[model samples]
Target: MNHPLYGYSLCAALALMLFFGIYFLTARTPDKPIFSNYLRSRRIMGVALLVLAANYLVHLLCELRFSHPDQAIFLNLSTYYLSAWLFSSALTSLLDRNYLCRNRFLRHILGWLLFTGVSAVVLLLMPAGIPQFIGLLIMAIWFFVYAFRLARRLVRTYRKAVRIVDDFHSDHIAAYIRWLSIFTYWAVVYGVGCGVLTFLPKRYVFLWVLSSIPFYIYLFCSYMNYLLFYEQVERILESEMECKPDTNLPDSEDTAPIGHLTIPPKLTLWLNGHGFTQPGLTIEELAEELGTNRTYLADYIKTTYHTSFREWITMLRLEYAKSMLVKHPEQTVSWISEASGFLSQSHFTRIFTEKESCTPARWRKLKD
Candidate 1:
């Protein structure tokens, strides 16, 4: 109670949570579905921010009023558990807007409230001995269960999103997924740490409050960054398809036989003419250019190239870069990466090294 760090950290956390709560809660977004979904997710920050800020405020009040602030321990545990749930819900919306729209989400919250409400009763009723410890232990275990579920779900979402994104875009999409992966790992770590620390002696809860600053900041930054990236990608896709009919929409013609939709001859010619070297090229754009459907183009690439559209394009780009490396040894890797249709030179080098087991510069020198 007398610790200087406790007061400072409590004040800092209160300010931050209130600020973030108001900012994200009131932040305006476009009317589009994608933007609206993100707005919904960001708004979760407001609820969580308010709950967590209130918890900290209570802690502050207790510390100031009580000669001993022992009763404030439950605040940290409850805040951590509920905050994790809110964080997971926000991310779940971004990945799948339809997820948890049913009874499961409600059940989970009800279960948390039930257990937490019980634990609080036990803690306040019991005379600060074994019974209180038992209550804390149960709360910690309950958190572990929920944390495990969230960790598993996050991993599953990461894997599926990576697969879909990599197969859909032939550009710098790796950067989007990389950040997602980092955030996923950090969320798991933060959850597990909080769960374990929840059972620790209440005197050490200043650590929990201090640690929360980074957790919330990192999550907010990551979510906003991802949302911005998603918006940029959406704008690019929209611009590419602007003024063109949305041919991919389902219709009776869509189910019609695709047998006559053999790979277009122009596809081969286009590939040979450096068509795949266009940065940010998508299967839809290529299909539109070829006067074919993305389905046919994707199937053709899968069958003939024995790879996804993205992988086929990437391999073609790699070959182009390799040839350029040999033919024009003086040209920089950056230039070759751009000419070869990569959105980023670092991305080019990463893919090149992954395939060849050597960097572009070394591969060029070795081929000499």
Candidate 2:
């Protein structure tokens, strides 16, 4: 507690929590499926985040509680934090059930025991060496056994559904999900790093805390890229893909670049140029730029690409934004939104929530 970095670290942690709370609560629409499904699970995860926030707040209180001998407040808060941490395993299990890893009642119970009990026991047993090490070990095992399978399923879905993109509304949902995978990886790395740093003494705390700065930078850059891409989407339409006024027909599988599929030269070249200039293009704008009506563009996108224009653009924007957010956390969300070519902050916020499954601000803060 005597460490000079303690205050800075505590403040940073608080900022992270506040940022996430605001982003999650405000980002999504009431009708969104992501906001609906797994309500219990969402609450559980939210509790965990809140508890962690409380834990940090308690740490600050502890530093100020010397005058009151009856001050058990911080201690109780710590208990709640740990308890919530334990419950988080079950929540995670439930979340996974919707994805590649099917969750059975038995498996969830066992996972809870392993994550909360066995893991805790191991940490207490080897206080200095085993906590983060064991955490990392368990995470590695979990990924290979459970998370990896889920990822494979997603990839399979992405590849198999290429033709169904236009007809399927699920493609947009899936696309948002795909981009989150990148954050998931970063979360694991940061979680492990944070745990390791926890065992260090006061003086060295800055070194440990400062480790997260790079992650913040990643956040900023990724958001900027997303903003830029969306802004250019409209202007670059015809160059990116061809449109026909005919029935949603099966696409030609020509020999062309892997990213572009067998797309027409006009469309392929536009995409290759990293989207049309303007830096603020969107689906509507792209349609206007191509002189292709929205109905035509939507039809072509649905039939040829097997997805909606919004979904397609969202997927592209979200991925680019995620990369920018990860790389440039210093930038504000407003900056990121503008750079991404969003019409307004509200639009960016809404679309980001609908498409990415999380707010841009929250996603970036979680990386911390």
What is the alpha-carbon lDDT of model 2 when measured against the actual structure?
A: 0.48
Q: Roughly what TM-score does model 1 have, to 2 decimal places?
A: 0.81
Residue 225: error of model 2 in Å? 14
For residues 201-270, could you state the per-residue lDDT of candidate 2 as single tens digits? Answer: 6467566546655654453244333333322221232223343343454345441123233234556666
lDDT agreement with native, every candidate: 0.74, 0.48
User: To one decimal, what is the Cα RMSD in angstroms of model 1 from the true structure?
Assistant: 4.5
The lDDT, on a scale of 0 to 1, for candidate 1 is: 0.74
Give the residue spans of candidate 2 off by over 4 A. 22-28, 31-35, 38-45, 54-106, 123-178, 195-202, 207-368
* TM-score for predicted model 2 compared with the true structure: 0.39
Residue-level error in angstroms, candidate 1, position 160 = 2.0
- Off-target runs (Cα >4 Å) in candidate 1 are 30-34, 64-73, 100-105, 126-135, 198-204, 232-261, 264-266, 299-307
User: How many steric clashes between backbone atoms does each model show?
Assistant: 0, 42
lDDT of 1 by residue, 309-362 (tens): 678889889999999999998899999999999988988999999999999999
